[model samples]
Target: MGGLSPAKRLYQTIIHQYSRTINCNSSNHLAQRLIQEPISRIKTTLDSETVNKSGDENLEFSWDSLLTCVHHHSPPKAQLVLEWRLEKLLKEKEKNENLYSDLIHLCGKIHDPQTAMRVFTSMESNHGGKPSSNVLDALISAHLSSNNMVTALSIFETMQNSDDYKPTAHTYNLFISAFANLGNSKAMLAWYSAKIASGFLADLDAYGALILGSVKLKRFEDAEKFYGEMLEARIKPNAVVLHSMLVGFCEQKDLVKIRGFLKGVLEHKWRIDGYMAEKLIGFYCELKLVEEMEWVLVALTETNHNQDLDTVSQIHNGLIRFYAKLDRLDDMEYSVGRMLKQGASFRSHKDVENVLCSYFRAGAYDRLDVFLEFIKDSHELARSSYELLVAGYRRAGLCEKVDLVIKDLETQRKE
Candidate 1:
């Protein structure tokens, strides 16, 4: 233990702490076991590796679990499971440069540049491992993720010094994306120029950066110009490119471009993310094109782009809200049933309130009661939602219905 490095000591400390607490809390036993089981397995595997000392580079040490900590969590915000395990990971005398690359990539993703650097430096110290192109890219990205441009570029310059790890188109895209996000068109173009001078034409990702930047800056014409050049390069526009184009057209209210873009989206079957679905649905709704909005849902199903449950729910909820705003009860009510049939339901309380309010405004009190009953079985009808209904009905002079809402709230409390 005295011979162990700080990273190794920390790893052992964590394992020891978890082991000691494994049986201490009876109420949280199941939860604690679920959390600690994998960690215990990791410790056991490491102990075995130490005993065997085979020094196999590819440790096969739960890549999925390691990478899972990266998603939807920033390092500063999360406990950073990756940071906790990754530095210790490199203490192993193995040359898993690829594994290290993935670790550093996750470090970049979580915006933990310090952990990224630790893992990178550990590569040479532990196993005399040389950095790969992927390693350098991830290292660069780790710095960029923290907006540490000086460090990122210094790393990029180091790449220029290494013949084995020079900048590729993807490396250029990293800088381009970082600058584009900063809205620094000058720096973005400079990187693009450098990419071209390096004898690498702009790839899909680089063009994506350019288009996305242009769209963000509201430079529709520049975005169109970049899109045209992308086409001239004989590169098929990806979902990101198409999404940017659609957003530009939507902003400009250029229906001709929108129609062409949507038609292309349908024909080419591009992936529509949740944001895209909401934007497209809201765009058409702004134009009062209800049929077009429904067609978007149909198009999603036909194109098999509705695989994400969240995105599907987003589309359905957007439509429900829009239909309520239009006071189209028949269509809105049918959509509610259809959303359930698709295994998506009213996930947002505000949307449910909008639906109830629509029914109330239309004087469909019987239908309102039916709708409440229909959803009550599945939806967690919040007390605040009941309060809202009572308030709405009371203002509309529906005394009896207000009493019913109060009763429902009381019943919910009892339940």
Candidate 2:
């Protein structure tokens, strides 16, 4: 076993275990013993056995839990155990229902999906155990998580062709969400329409997901149409639906549309959270609507002085960038000063710091000076401040400051 490959070792271990457990002359006694022990005890005993054998603390016997654990566990070691056990089962070719049920459960438990797929495939190839829709569902889920939508789709389509294997709305919903995330509105809509035609009532979440996908695809009209149909179907739009609509408007850069959406949200008496406000502010910034951006920023600050710093930092950097591009030194100074006064958060964001560093490097030196003055001794600038300070002095033609920074940098390097 020591000289064998990990896969071979795993195979041997699984074979040895299966032989010891299943190949007894007292098969009835083993069954009685299993029945005597509660399922919980059986599970705990199985887990303990695996842990002791593998000496891997994270190895779990439950299929789903084991998937996550074995993923981060040693792959070769886990794969060996899985392959060996599956191979031994295949070699047995027994009609023992208990053994088959255990193998099916183990098929689900195997962490490496490729290994699971192989075992399932092998069951179809050599073993007489039938592949169930649950097996297909597992494969689809694993592939989708890996962003292998094509493989998921193939499994789905294959499952659909089997007259005995009718997919439920849950199945279609899974595919819809997957396609929507990939920005494939056409496929999402197709599945959505198919669900409708099949006389399945679309859940609010499903409609919301499809509408959101439409928004991402820039099909605002389609999204609006869907919303109308949703209302006609007597389904109330949830906060998620409204947020997706707002996002759609933002994507279109249609401030008027977004205003209308926001007005509707207000009419519905929904409170704005940081995410929605951030989206609205981001929309204005994207369109370079500086006045609108300022208004939104001030409104947010007044409404909640302790609002999220990440959003404020985003709004601040957007203005800094706008000013830098337009060469509006006065506006830049005003924005930086306002930020300092408001105690804006997100001065700590990596992108914000990079933008500030760029501003200094590009001889927006006055703006850089203001930012450094404001951020100094602040927690935000504790990191990379030395580098920016060095860059700043180099740009300002301060040879003494540059030399001191360079010497300090070298000393830190050695340490």
Candidate 3:
């Protein structure tokens, strides 16, 4: 035994390590002493009738102990013991009633999905026992977790057709959701549509998935169509569906349609809030559609006249900024005046600067004069406001007028 090769010595070291934990400890430097015997000797001892005598009580502890060794040892070192012990328990046991659920669950915990599938398949073939929903669900989820959608779909298709395996909406929804997660939105939509045509109405979750996917793909038309079909099928839209539609419309900058849809929600006595209105207003303003932005703001005030002040300010600031960006001096002035009339006077420095810049750039000398008269008479000049007027005079070929402003500033400072 001492004359054995180091490779054989390493194998013996592993077996002895496990034996120390499971059985009586002997300083059996079984390392060199046991090296001459075949590795199958240890494998056989693990799977022998002696261990099967206690049935699942002992099988559980044995398998659990064997698994720890299998994980700790390299594949070449533990392969014989792992395969032999698994085969022995599977073949020799009549049925493990108490361990069935646990074993089924264990199949999912195993890293190699193919091995888990083989174990489950073997259990079906030898025991002729039907797998439970929990077991099947675990198997489907396992395959999905591995991104093996083809195998997972095959299992789902079989389950749907089986008399014993009743497919619930959750089952279909889950399969659809897995495909959706893969960004196979078209396939996800087709599957549910096919199921519905076959007279199987998947739950709202399935439709919700389609809506979200369609929105993500920027297919607002498809999303809206699918939404209508859901409603027509008598599947009420949940908050997610409603929110998805709102966000989809917002992305498309369809403020008009969003307003109409939101109004419909309100007419049904659904709650409307300032945040939703802000989203609508912000979308239109981003598109620089001043008219549509105003329409949404008016609708908001009409729907909830006591709208939050902060929301009102956000909407007004957005409108001013939009017109100013386009250099629509008249439009910008009108929007600011309307906001002031609405008693919204906490002006944004940015909004004021934008208006001045637009006015200066527009080169409307008469309009610049009106602004100057307003500033002088009002006796209110933000530091930048005067700078804009000086720039405005220079651009209008009134350099003398600009110099006059500088002279006035010097006199005021001296005084």
Candidate 4:
């Protein structure tokens, strides 16, 4: 076994081990042990024996085990293992499409597009093998992974010109996704149009990328247009895409469009998630659309029974903060009550500060006293709250009240 090449030695070791195990144990037990054995251990064992081995030997290598290591281990080591295997395969004049594809994909995974391209080039010239579409796709994907869009597109063009390969919807989606991630709306749309012209209908992922890219570019109208096209094509928008569109509308501050779009969503009985509901309430409050805000809040409270507690607390705090800013103490108190009913602690320091300031600014001493008492009973008053109260009293020429607040703060700090 030591006289044999590393690949042959590895094969012999596996065969001997398997034969010995099978003879002593039941087949089921042997199968279970093999299934439970970690691929990492196997790869490590092979790596320890194979390192420094020459590729002059024409022994067969287990590509599957090597590929597994390439995916799950360090890229540099995996690449070395792959290169070693490729050299052996080449020396034996064996052509394996899967091995070449995995090599290209690993290069991409490691962001080594140069090595990936070299592997691709050598597949035909050095290995005398025709590159399949899958291999080309891997090469293109590798370039895209590195954000080398120019090289990726060049390879894609090459693939298109080749008689043996044609780009799939997946390939086009990668371009759209890359451009979208770069926030290049123009390029993304151009590619989208090209995809459509190539007689391939845009999939859900393609539409999502286009919608997001348009939104990032502040092209709300175009985003809506793409959404409409999605609807017409009967391609349902997922929660993520819908939220992106809503966010785009909010950014554009087109209240009419948001209202109409939301109305349509409700009319069509589309699912409105907690995040979307929160955004709607926030935007409505920002626009001072009290009626719309109230409607949405009511619907959200009713529908979001099973929603996350943190999100519900955030929505309540948002409403309280908004109402406090407008000096609507009654509405603010109402929101606070709702928040408390949900078993949420009043934790937003900003909202507490805003309400306190609003009361002091409006000379509503009675309301301010009530709020202070409430905070005291709830034990939610921090040292910062006392400081803010003292500042407010001092600003209002209430020197005695300021002194009292300072004393209270000192007592609380000691406690």
Best by TM-score: 1
Q: Number of clashing residue pairs in every model?
A: 0, 3, 0, 0
Report how far residue 307 has shifted in candidate 4, in Å: 4.4
Please report, in order, the local distance difference test score of every candidate based on alpha carbons: 0.73, 0.61, 0.61, 0.70
- Tens digit of per-residue lDDT, candidate 3, span 143-235: 665676666666666565555655555666767767767778778877787667767766788888888778877788888998888878878
Superposed by TM-score, candidate 1 places the C-alpha of residue 312 at a distance from the truth, in angstroms, of 5.3
Task: After superposing candidate 4 on the true structure, give the runs of residues whose Cα lies further than 4 Å from its correct spot.
Answer: 1-147, 161-165, 180-190, 193-200, 216-221, 232-234, 263-286, 305-309, 343-347, 375-379, 394-415
Model 3 / residue 403 / CA error / Å = 20
Which residue pairs in candidate 4 have backbone atoms (N, alpha carbon, C) closer than 3 angstroms, thus clashing?
Answer: none
RMSD of each candidate?
9.8, 13.1, 18.4, 13.5
- Give the winner by lDDT: 1
Q: Find the 10 residues in a row with the least total lDDT in model 1.
A: 22-31
TM-score ranking from best to worst?
Answer: 1, 4, 2, 3
The segments of candidate 3 whose C-alpha lies over 4 angstroms from its true place after superposition are 1-148, 154-165, 180-186, 197-202, 215-221, 233-240, 243-259, 269-283, 305-313, 327-415
Give residue 251's error in model 1 in angstroms: 2.3
